[model samples]
Each structure stands twice: as C-alpha cells, then as structure tokens.
Target: MIRWGTSAWLGSLAVGAILAATVTFAGVEDRADAGRALPAPTLSTPPTSSPRPTTTTTTAPPDPCGAVAAGMSSRARLAQLVMVGVDPRGADDAVDQVRAEQIGGIFIGGDAVGLLSGGALGSVHATASLPLTVAVDDEGGRVQRVDQLDGELPSAREMVARYSPDEVRALAHKRGAALRARGVTMDLAPVVDTSDQPGRTVIGDRSFSPDPRVATAYALAFSDGLRAAGVAPVLKHFPGHGNTTGDSHLGSVRSPALDALRGTDLVPYRSLPEFGDVTVMVGHIDVPGLTDGRPASVSPAAYALLRGEFAFAGPVMTDDLGAMRAVTDLYDLPDAVLHALAAGADVALWSSGGRTGEVLTRLENAVASGELPQARVDEALRRVLHAKQVC
Candidate 1:
C-alpha cells in the first residue's frame, strides 16, 4: 500500500529553493575514482522480495531467439527500428500491422493498461509471428501510464524528496514488477537530465536531481532494479535535456553553452558505460556545436557524439516524431521518419499523430532508392531485434 501522509507532500517544498540549495557533488570521477566505498551487489545475497505471487502458474515458453545474437534480418530486423504507437484500447488497425509488419515494438499510453490486461495484448502476442517489445513511460509522478487503474506512483522528484538513491531503486524495482505482471516488457524511464536551468520548468520534477552525481546514482539504480525485474530500462534525453528552457513537445529548444552542458548536463549518459546494458533515448534539443543548428534527432554529429565519444553501443532511440517542433504541419509525414533515420537515430519512437504507415512506407522507398544506406539500417535493426529478443 502506498503510504499517503505529510511525508509524501510535494506542494509545501519550494522546488526553486531546493534546486538553488542543492550542493553539486565533486566533479564526477571516472567510475573507478568515486571514493564512496559501498560493497558491490553479489549473486550470493539478494534484496528482499516484493509481495508474494497470488498463485504459482505455468510460465510462458522461452523465446527461441532468446540466446541468439543480434544480426541483420530483412524482415524481423526492419521491424525493430520502427517503434509505433498502438491505440490505448488496441485498435484492429494496430493489431493488423503488428502481425503483418512483424513490428519490433509498441509504445502505450495510460489508457492502454486495459488493453494490456484485458486480452488485447494477449491476442496480439498470440497472433504475431515474432517477439515484440511492448513499452510504456511509467516514470511515476507526472509521466505515469498505469495510474488511472493502479493509482498514481510518486514522481521522480517526489521519490527523491522522501528517499535516498537506494530507496528510489527499490521503488523502481517494485514499479517494474507491477508493469511486468501486466505484460509490459520495457520501461521508457529514468529521465537522466540534470534539471537546473530556470527555463526547464516542464522537466523540473521529471528529473531526479539538479546534482549530476545524484542524477547518475539515481538513474543507475532505476536501470539496475528494472533489469532485475525482467524489464528493460531506457535512460532518456541523451546528450542532455536539462539545460533547455522550452518544451520539445511545443517548439524547438536549445541547451545552454556547450561548455556548461559538457560539465553538468551529460553526466548521466557519460556514467552509463560503467552501469551495464542501458538504452539511451535521444532528445530533440539543438545544441549549437554538437547539432550544427539542427535538432539532435536530425543531426549526424549528435549521433556520432553518442556513438563515438560516449561509446554507447546499445540501441539509440529518438523522442516522439510527432512532438518534435521541426516536424510541422506543412511537411509530409513520411519525411519526419526519413530525416530522423538519415540523421542516425536507430529507433523512431511513438508516432504521436496517425501516420506511422506513411513513415514506414517512406522508409521503404528510401531503402529502394538507396538513399538511406543499407548498413545503417541493418545496424539499427539489429539493435532493435536484440532489444526485443531480450524483452
């Protein structure tokens, strides 16, 4: 049961004051040099279990591709790179595509919990020829998807208010388990952006803390706990989203000076190499030096920084194409998909508007015309398939 009381209240706490007072931990050291001497987790000892299972039931059959390494596949592979939105109630049009297209994954909204639990997902799983990575943004507090049915969980900032990084991890663990029981396989979560700028009021409480070290620690904990619960975790707004003032959902946004971003905003992504398997989500921020005036989702230079500088080999996904300010009403829907893939983004996440097929068809044309290199597509597909296989 969620403890509801004075401890959980967030309104009384002034966010700006808390942020202004937050002490920056020493500049982050290489994972090796952080002097904190906590013992590493071992297989011999496990954390306490959550509430018991109501009944022991037969387990689902293992995936044949479970242990198979990721590789290029004409059909299965192409589907992985296309992450599309399905109707929260699981519309027939969505199910048809899931089966025929053999899509790699699906993103759901809050209303989708009914579809997931009430046989919509079960039927799709039964009908689909290949495994699918079903994901949702249940980041607690503001970005919760299952709250309407299961009750609201605390926000990321709220959790940080009441607990230490360790406790936040435990909360994420329980949250992951609940989603898993409802058949969700992936969590688009742990907003790793260091929310400090006054202009970033939108992502204010969505971020863990203004302190990079605190942000990194809390993010790593959530990722660790989700994986422990058999749910894949994605660290988002890569390169960074913290320094930007405008909401990407509305208009084009840019971060503060590249120097300031390097020092504070990117701490979480920089820390991921030591954190084990983690997926990074690219935001739509336009950093002057890194993106060269284009949004990060549509910039090759931004992708190179994440792949080359950060050395993040796991999948890299773009934020919602529909929400992107660069994608406007005047442009054809398919161009959004083409531009993002061409720019080096791997997974094209939730098509906010209803034009997923239009985008997919354009991608197919790009493949046929040899505009988008087959190698890049193959690499992106491989990453997507590997994620689905793991899920």
Candidate 2:
C-alpha cells in the first residue's frame, strides 16, 4: 500500500499541478489494464523515444489430416479408402500401383517371401504420398501368412489350451514384432467369434473359445501384445460368425438372430474394445433378422448395430468382397465396393487385386452422379487415416 500526507499536497499551486499529473498517469495505467488502446498525443510527440511495436496473437496450425485429405484430387482421395491385394512376388509392380493411384494400403496374402523377406516393403512405404497400411491375415494355424519366415504359430484354440492368457500375450508380442519387422502394419487376427464346433470346422479352430468372457480375455491379451509391438490388431466377423452353419467363401451364409447373438457372439465386441482400440472387420455373412439378404459387410443396418448399438468408434472394414461368394452372387467387385462404402465401411478390402482401375472409375462416376455422397467418402477417408495413424 502507498500513503500520502495532506501536508505533501496542500496549500500550494505547484503541489496541485503535481497531483493532476499523477492522476493522468494512473488513468493511463487503468486504461492499459482494461485492454484499451492509449490515447494518442495531439502534437504527435515521438522524437524523444522510439514507439513500441505491436504484437500478434498466435493461432493453432490447421489440421494435418484434413490438410492431407483436402490436398488430393477427388479420385485420388477415393483411391486411398480402398485396400487392394498385391501379388507377393510382384513387389515392384505393387509399388508402381501405389505411386500411380495414391493407393491407401496393400494386403500381403499367400506367402511368396519376396515382399516379406528381402526388405522389399521399404520401397512400398516410400512409394505412397501417405504411409501405406501393409496388412496380412496372420491369424495363426492354417490361416497364417508368414509361417515360413517366422515359424508356425498355434491356432487360437490351441494357444488357449496350451498357454495361459499372459503366455499367449507374450507369444503374440513375439509374433507381432516379427510382423512389424517385416513391415506388416495390420494383423487381421485373434478371431473373437464364439464357437463350439470341432477343431476342424471353419471358424471352430480359429475361435478362442465358446465362452464369450473367455474369448474376450484372450482377444484383449493378444491385441495388447500387438499394440505393444506397434501393429494394429483387428477383431473379425462382427455380430459373430462362430455359430453359423456354412462359410461365405462358398455361398451365402447366415447367422442366428440378433437376440441370440447378444447372449453369445456379440459379447466379445461389447467388452474387448473397452480394453483397447482395434479395427473391426464386418463379415460377409447375412443376418437372418437384420441383413434382409444383403451380407453384413454391405448392410447399413448391420453397420448401425456396430457403430451405434455396440458403440465401437474404431475403424470398421469389410471382409474380402472380391472372392466371397455371398457378394459375387449379387454384384461385381466395383458394385460390392460401392455398397460397402455407402453402408459405412471405412475400408473396402478385396484380396483379388486386379480391377482397381475399374472400381476406382466406377467410384468417381458414383461421386459425380451423387449415388455415393462425397461426405461419405470423406468420412471413410478420415477413418482410413485414423487406422493408419496418419491423423
């Protein structure tokens, strides 16, 4: 606090002048405190000192993900949402494809040792403007892709039978690290479907267990290990494929009612994602009460169940549309791709790599004609960015 005595300012004209100057100085200070600009001097008195320079408030930089998406041509951006399979031997050709199309990702299906062995994937990573999502179906058992290089891993059921959940996690970490070392970014693995069929049945051996809680625990552990290795783990066959009677590869397959799935197959999804982030693969099987004949991979209702009911916010991809008989019976590769995107899939994957140009052309035409909204394409592109961690 400051103090002033009456004797210091009373009974004198000079004292009154000093008091008025002090009042002016304090008023200027108050105006500065209030964020108001100071009044300019009438005579423009600046010869005695240099004036203070003005400053600017800083702003946040624009969104890098949005900037990358906006910088591409319409067809080029659409190309990024489609993941095509590449011949494992034709690594150079695949690199050329990504350079030409601004392709989003590639799947390394059917072991050829060329792409996964001799550091060929380094060139593929460099070819794209964005980082490519190099993926594989390294689900272990007969479904494993790189067994020749990394040695064989047990089936999901076998892992559970022989090892504890933590041990399975350690084994999966070793597997994921091997995949990452080979430049594989995504693993379509650890099937969470609930099944009780014989070990030789289609999804039977691939399933972790018939018990939903057990399946969820093992899936979480496996995914944790994959995440620890910087590879994204994918949960497969949304709405469940374990109890289904047939395979979608041969013909259209159907699952039990939604009510029944809620008690069994759907249990893993509701719990697994709560533990960690994983991309969900919607299967080709049609649901009796939900899909109306369309496979879940192409059904809006099924996606709604995944996106809304189950509340899964991670990336959602469609199972292979190129070879699946369920979809081939109705539409060609291009149409199947379109329906999956329009139905809310983030990525449209086709293990059959040809026809990329044909499908892309159709997609461009769809955007021009409004059959597929540009907003929908943008939304999916954002999800693709999320999956690749580009955003």
The lDDT leader among the candidates is 2
Whole-model lDDT values for every prediction: 0.70, 0.82
In model 1, which residue pairs have backbone atoms overlapping below 3 Å?
A: 141-154, 141-155
Tens-place lDDT digits, model 2, residues 1-391:
0001011222221111111111111112333347655557567665334445444444455565676677789998899888899989857868977987978878888768799987888888877766678889988887898899999999999888998899988988999889888888788987999998998887988999999998998888888888777778889989789999788888888899888999889999888546566789999987888888789999999999998888887778889999889888889999999999999898899998878899999999999999999999988887776555555
Error of 1 at 205 (Å): 0.4
Q: Put down candidate 1 lDDT per residue, 1-391, tens digits, no spaces.
A: 1100111222232122111222333332345546866566589966333444344334455443332324334445556677787777754745776876767677786455556666566666655555666778988877888887666878777777788878877878888877776767778988888885442376888888889988888888888787777678888887788878687877888887667788877877777776676678888888877787777887898889888878888888888886556554323557766777888888877556356556667787788788888788876765664554432
Candidate 2: residue 187 lDDT (0-100)? 89
In model 2, the number of clashes is 0
Count steric clashes of candidate 1. 2
The TM-score of predicted model 2 comes to: 0.84
Find the 10 residues in a row with the least total lDDT in model 2.
Answer: 1-10
Question: How do the predictions measure up, each by TM-score?
Answer: 0.77, 0.84
RMSD of 2: 16.6
